[model samples]
Target: MHVDVKELKGHPGAQRTLSRTVEAPSGLGTVLVGIAEHSDLDLDLRVESVHEGVLLTGTASAEVTGQCGRCLDPIGYPLTVDVMQLYTWTPEANQTDGDDEETREVTAELTLELEPVLRDLLVSALPFQPVCRADCPGLCSQCGFRMEDDPGHAHEQLDPRWAALASLADTLNHDDEDDDASS
Candidate 1:
């Protein structure tokens, strides 16, 4: 949303409030493939300017839908972020000292780019690993089975190399048990 800071610049203590719904973009870096399903985003931003270019503070709220990292099931979460920023207007290059302008004219008319900022905020808030449910039985490593769907599916250990390691581990466990018994 574009805000006109012209009035605020003139009045040092002036402040303004704004509200709008913005649609944010989605891509590889913007939103993760598995996490964010849709590119469209809905956000509510409330902005207030204080002390000229010194500070701008506001709050933003949004809702996003994505897929769980583990089960790939759809998930939705609400997001709210507090925003604070500083603005500096570019000075005119060609103006000379002989013009006798006492005070530099500052304008508050500026467009705040919210997409990149919003994307970063949302992505940072997401969990590294998302589960569909609290007690989600994830996919079995052995036979590619969905543990949640079939709890009865027996995991067959087919790797003979692992079997040798398993036997050695069992032997070590027995040795420990024997030592404890002797003690």
Candidate 2:
């Protein structure tokens, strides 16, 4: 979504309420991280002229699909999130002593693009490690089987001394699962 900054840029204290459906740019599928690209998003926002710049506050939503991070099963879901952002005029609106790249500015055309903002928030809101359910057993490392499909999935108990080599594989799998969870 792009808002005309002229509507509020110089008109300090001005306000406008907008409700629009905006298409996420093509190839947004890559930006989704784990979810499917959303062709469009529903946005309900209030643009207010603030001393600093244009303050946009509201909510955005989209339907998305992803796979459970563990079992790799298809997961269809909807994502809804609240977003608040300030788009400022360059240089003059650069109130911070921070890096120039850190400031979000309005375009020379006096337009504020909201695509990046929505994409960032939506991607971050999605589960880093999504699951079909909280208690999903995921897949068995031994036979590449869906554990939930067969909750009793397991290998036969082997002799302890000889089992060390076999159990070592499970240990490695546990470590991998841990690493994935941390990320």
Candidate 3:
């Protein structure tokens, strides 16, 4: 989704409102966990000319599908996030004061390609560790089955630190039984 800055190029403080649905690039959600690529995103944006260059501000919405990070169950959800970005016009005059990475340099032709920005915004809104539900009972460690479906899931676990103690107790019991039998 590239926007031509022609309208706001020569005139300062000019603005334009845009609303369109664009297909996100394939595999855009690969950067985030449990967030599959979305086919289309509806962008409602306002492009305004500023002293530096142009400011893009609006909200975008899309639907993403993937598996829950915890239980690995199929999951799909809608994602909507705000976007406020400034693409500063290049050259020695309008240099941004912030970190070099934080600033966006405009192309010589005055075009703003928004694919990267949209991808970053959507990916950031996604949960780092997704879950099927708020209080999802993840897969049982012992059986790797959905714990919610099997409420009685359990495993007999012995800490390695107590293994030696358990063996000593068993040996003591066996010795006591041998003495009693001899008596």
lDDT of every predicted structure (CA atoms): 0.55, 0.76, 0.80
Better of 1 and 3 by lDDT: 3
User: Which model, 2 or 3, shows the larger TM-score?
Assistant: 3
Ranking by lDDT: 3, 2, 1
> Model 3, range 1-183, lDDT digits (tens) per residue?
688887698788789899998776765564324334447788999999888778899999888777777788778888889998888887553453655555475777788888888878887778878777899888888779888888788899999999999999999999999999999
lDDT of 1: 0.55
Better of 1 and 2 by lDDT: 2
Model 3, C-alpha of 141: deviation from truth (Å): 1.4
Can you list the residue pairs that collide in candidate 1? 5-108, 5-109
Which number leads on TM-score? 3
- Where does model 1 exceed 4 Å of error? 28-46, 51-54, 90-109, 162-183
RMSD of 2: 12.8
- Weakest 10 consecutive residues, lDDT, candidate 2? 26-35
Which clashing pairs does model 2 show? Answer: none
